[model samples]
Target: MNKTVSLDEIPYSPDSCERFEALRELPGAAFLDSSYPHSSSGRYDIMCAQPVACPEQPALAATETAWQQYFDELRRFHKDYYGTVQPASQDIPFCGGLLGALGYDGGNSLNQVSGAPPATRNSGGHLAAYNWAVVQDHLLQRAVMVAQPSMREADRNDVLSRLRSQRRVKHTEFQLGGKFESNFTESEYRSAFESVQSYIHAGDCYQVNLAQRFNAPFTGDPWTAYRQLRRTASAPFSAYLSFENNDVMMSLSPERFLSLHGNHVQTVPIKGTRPRYRDSGADRLAVEELKRSSKDRAENLMIVDLLRNDLGRSCIPGSIHVDALFEVQSFPTVHHLVSTISGELSPDRSAYELLRDSFPGGSITGAPKRRAMEIIAELEPDSREIYCGSVMYISADGRMDSNIAIRSLLCTDNDIRCWGGGGIVADSQWRQEYQETFDKVGKFLSVLEEMS
Candidate 1:
């Protein structure tokens, strides 16, 4: 059954920006901040939960009909004010409120992707939380959401140390979280190269994203940990995903999958990558390498084409264009060559239509999306619940924004798992591609090890 509790019942001042942080400190309430500044509605949102019996996917899916019904009601309410408020169901993979209803117990769910238990629990990391069902109250008028606080405390250092120990035991561990080439194995690295070559030979797809997993435990205040990561990595658009039994956190990101500002919609796609260096000279060299690498360029351009096509579906005719291409943006651990694809959205299109057109991002899926998805499904045994999905915030005024789900963490009752990877094309060298994944995860793993 669905329940609703006003922000007033919590300790925080609902009107304050810090309401999210205050609510996060509340008892049995896990907070998810969409930070929907692009919308005309309210700013911060929340997702709260009280103890409830666990329900698996089948039982959980049964709520889909009701969820759609509730969403339709919301749409009707906003139709007069705004052309259409993006439905809650329209929020992609990491939709905040929907993730809460999906539950926070993360034990078996962790193994579902990693094939091994995670070091921590809470796996609803990147969600497409859609709607809120208020049993007794009128629907919320803004982009606000409600989630209860977590039942457990997540300590950073403890979690970090636990991950380090696990890595050692698994023999898959790399020192420095394998940020540089010095830490990873040649065999593992070569495997990625071989896969790229095989894919190329078979003509299955132009590029494919390959990733690996890392685990850790926790010992510090999780909210503090999130703030620290944000300071260190500081993504342009960021999100904090946490649940009662699990937490998924991220800090470094350079892509915007989609956004709805008033009636306008947009998406930014990133397609190339290079590791960052401490020395300015080294950094320049890495960016230079990324720019000059034909393989990377080809891979990036292919995705650009894919993104353009994806946006074209819901976008106004002749409005689609590559705003920026092959622009390198530097992060703490890596340098990435990204592209911006923009379009004037078709007035009749819905958020779900936009997502369906661009479900798995081009960077992750390759040139031809459906074919690449098929290959990915075959190569990977695990189901990508929310990794490639987008995390979005939709206002009551029909405005929204979302980020590509990458460099993210997932947690459940028993484990914590984070995934990172890069796109591989025909000329791709497997070793380099594999190492890139490690580099992407470096800082995250470092923090996790510190806690462990």
Candidate 2:
């Protein structure tokens, strides 16, 4: 196992111990926990990244060469386990880099974490970021996952209580910000129209997902906040993931990254969106409007087609099809038009290869995947990191599943940031697109403000 410890950086403490214990109870498991905290937010989250292949058996030898060999073996394991492989895509060259460099290599490890340098809060906003495709050269192909499936909620709660009791000072926390109804004042709508006109004229993109960040303070554990959001409004295939130090806590989302079972692979890409009214009747009307909106439907269809093409690359001959199209689904925040695409995998293929073919989902990137990605690189500020990318996991039996990393947070040593966006299309209104982003991030922002 690649155990990364930084004795000079931050010593392991009771909090880490509690999390480790909580996850250790699971069968055939491995753990990847982080301690990065969000500055000002004062919240840290711990993530149980993945489960090891064999928990009881003595681990494979640990040498530099051995590590490389282990990864090669894991690749085969994925192939044998999933029976399909992601196709090689020039669009996602960076997938390998992210996995190998930041994820598996010592890059993300604590031993390599400290004393090299310190970053100014938000100071690196202007720093040049690389595209995921380009970063592929830096990543390790296979990640080390620790699975501890036997840990119970009660056990975790006890550990939390113990840690809380041991704290010498009252801890700070985060809270929810309140909801907002933009109502699009008349002049504001006009401005939005103008923005769309400008975008159309520029030909920068046919569509853009617009959004706003909500600033708020949260008053307790970010993980608890995530649980509440999830429990209060659950979505099928929804996920709750935390990174070490609560730097990354996500209860996401309205999108699916990928799902594979018994040679059947599918992806549901959500695009078009509209707000839900608080009034029952109005909400119904709003949802109906969203379902029929030409702009929204068109956007959803485009993504569906994109997904079909992605699945086609890995599926058996004549096995690809669109299972669902333009279906409106309701989430806690908004209504979305989503489409599902599925295909029977080639018997010779494997899940790792399947993902290789379509890593960093197409929905977020847009049509002519590679071209769209290049556009995104020019437009977006930083590398998407986990945002827009998907969090993937494989079951012991080799069922592959992943979640699109939207409605998510990425934290380092001193800051936490979350990203949200909407798909833009030819007929899209810029202001409306912007509002969609706000609608998406509204809840998280409110909660953050509340905490503050």
Candidate 3:
């Protein structure tokens, strides 16, 4: 059953980084900060820590049916609170959503995308798990501690007191090892780019997002690294998730895969990118260039069309439509052409059903999504566990929100793995596409070097 305990609002400064550090003492924490707070309804910044309940190490299912069953059970645990409270007439409350990372391999359960299985990877032993915890909403200036109905008042008070008494975090020195290693060499990536082109020419698929992974041995605090990443790339959909076995997922994603408010569902897909120039004049020119680029516009439009169809599977027929199109949004390192699409959920559909129809967001996959995923599985070597998948939350009221896990990192005890790539289209230049990957990951690499 849904249960909320009002707690004393902790003394928090508006500095997101410092606030995050203060809350780091909690185990199995999840922090989400929005870069563009003006775009959201007030509750954009949140920190959920100290899971009241979670799996020890949950394994990812191999099919959608299994995933569906898993989520159903998860939701059933907190159903009373899922969509029980609405802050406003049209707004969904900051109640609850599953907090975890969905790996790229999770796609297998959704559709028949053939590819090599992910390397025998070591990511805290579980692909995905959800948790319920004490959530602090920065915008609301309040903290809501969620617990099982049977939890004792003394135990609840102890959790609240700990959150209220968090100390300032100390800075730690991180050791950076040798140069980062890539799964694919430059020549190999070029060859793959050319191969994708060949497929496009053959009309196999319209577009596909191909990416490469980078890894480096490291010993330090992952939370510090996440703070540095956020400083460098303050994206609207940034998140940090810590698992039970000490594995952490850090994301500074600029794209939203999907969001649900009441019966209204929305998604904003980002398809085009251009590196931001240091000079103000040059930056303006770059933005203008991206705005007028036919290739970039066409690429974005195709994904827009694809997402409309994806939503159609779960939305009322006449309720789906594009809310915005071809709008260029600038970030610290790049400018992106993003489009927003919204629809009314069909009465029979649930959030899990919505995810079933739109897993591994179309923006990351190519047009004719299933076929492009098949090609992606054929070409990419490692399983995209978490990368290009999503960090999501589904509320009992059927409200949900998720981020395309780009500009993300998976941190284990000994090493950090990062991935970067872009869409390959018929007119995509091989050299540009190659550079785009670096442009996307440049901040991540730079922050690691600084911390090292």
Candidate 1 accuracy as TM-score = 0.66
Which digits, one per residue and each the tens of the lDDT, describe model 3 over residues 72-158?
A: 555455454343533321232444445666776767556665454553343212323222344445565544544433445775676
Each model's backbone clash number: 61, 73, 5
Candidate 2 runs further than 4 Å off = 1-21, 24-74, 77-172, 175-220, 231-233, 242-246
Candidate maximizing TM-score = 3
Question: What TM-score fits each model?
Answer: 0.66, 0.61, 0.89
The full ranking of all candidates by lDDT, starting with the best, is 3, 1, 2
Which digits, one per residue and each the tens of the lDDT, describe model 2 over residues 213-275? 222323355554554444443444333433333344353555777877768898988887777
Q: Give me the runs in candidate 1 sitting further than 4 Å from their true place.
A: 1-19, 26-189, 217-221, 244-251
Model 2 poorest 10 in a row by lDDT: 127-136
Please identify model 3 stretches exceeding 4 Å from their true place: 1-8, 35-43, 52-61, 71-92, 119-151
